[model samples]
Target: MSERLPPNTKIRGTGFNISDFWSWGFSDVLTNSLRGVFAEFLVGSTLDVLQQPRIEWDAYDLMYKDKKIEVKSAAYIQSWHEGQYSKISFGIEAKRAYNYATRSYTPEPVRNADLYVFCLLYEKDANLIDVLNTEQWHFYIVKTNVLNTLFPQQKRISLSTLEKITQPVSFTEIKETIDQAIYQ
Candidate 1:
């Protein structure tokens, strides 16, 4: 039961050349490929847009209203390398979320124009399938950088409360997911 993306699946690349790590100093073809997959589908066809490393914006991806979006693409892997035993990840060297409730994480300088975000492009279907079933697929959304300032921590936060803090196009609630991503 294995299948590949359609020849005309139309996955567009943003031509973004992100480094694997400041330490690695090498561009990762795999990560960029996945990013291309996500960018093509982030808007779900309502608007046709593609994101890449060279979008000519001050950020990563562009939005429906022509807003410049800074994208942080990540792929987490639990494994050990050459001589180290660790569960590492192939990711954009940027943290893509904000928690106004905590203000704990460090991110790029896009607070006002560069909305904090996380774009996860995965090929595995079991983890997240049926919602948007395309290998050339990815999810995009803005995070709540002001949650701590705007929320009551002791209480469970809900999506409706953070509804305003999301991508203008996809409108995906992103902060909580980024939190979960850090731990899970």
Candidate 2:
């Protein structure tokens, strides 16, 4: 375990299962990754075009311009079931990275935004486990309209609808979705 550490890694695995511990850390990694990915897309594809400042709230995994364009990451999951497969919970599993530039802490600023869109990567070919890998990074964007068709159910809900989950996107249908969003 010591050998695996760089030099100042705060984590110590004197007796803990390093592999198992690492698995939990994956959630943190994914959250941050999604934050960065969402921020980049919001700023690059949308804000940059509109000429906005790129500011990221590292602690909250938030980003935007004039502190109005808010961006977030989430996953989607079934909410009307039970058990792990039945009951649905949101955090880091079944959701999408979202951008909320249309709203603000104030009422007027929230309503006056010009172009407001909440984007998701909506991968077609990538897998869930693959995204969890610290090495593999899929920081891309796809339109909400396209994201809907990929999933079997709803399409294009308000950004607030996305789950606040933080787990890696499941590989199941991920690659398939990415392919669809990117190509046809």
Candidate 3:
């Protein structure tokens, strides 16, 4: 004879709740999705630009006027604990040709977008992951052409190195900063 347990019932003496473990695993995916969305929203709202909500995996996150903008975000406090400030790096991949038949990507040295926006959540205290706190978040904008020429073979750029080439700007100053980078 066998006994069936209820959906919410915990097994004999394991001492741990299975549902709690599942929630822990799912939190990573949720956190990442939220982070990306928050970054896009912050940029769009500050610049007074509308976001393209339906676009996915299309290279860029938002479209403003005649420019294509790619947004990348990083946080100091992630799933694990860190002893020091987290190093932030945003991917700058060249647009590649995809072969549908073979499902392979060919590397091309072409820039996909006009500009890149790097967002950082630098909270030394791991407890502060709240997107509502504007002071914890920082934004840096750089031109795609400048990044390609400076980084060349590198696909990622660190915040420190990026600061050498360009300074971090507030959300409200994004448009003016980008315009300066372009016209200068």
For candidate 1, what is the TM-score? 0.33
CA lDDT of every candidate: 0.37, 0.34, 0.71
Compute the lDDT of residue 80 as modeled in candidate 1.
18
Clashes of 2: 30
Q: How does residue 4 of candidate 2 score in lDDT?
A: 34
Q: Which regions of candidate 1 deviate over 4 angstroms?
A: 1-29, 32-46, 50-57, 77-117, 122-140, 143-184
Number of the predicted model whose TM-score against the real structure is largest: 3
User: Who wins the lDDT comparison?
Assistant: 3
Q: Judge candidate 3 at residue 10 and give its lDDT.
A: 67
Model 1 vs truth, CA RMSD: 13.7
> Which candidate, 2 or 3, would have the higher TM-score against the true structure?
3
lDDT of 3: 0.71
Q: For all candidates, what are the clash counts?
A: 11, 30, 0
Estimated TM-score per prediction?
0.33, 0.26, 0.70
lDDT of 3 at 1: 18
Models ranked on lDDT: 3, 1, 2
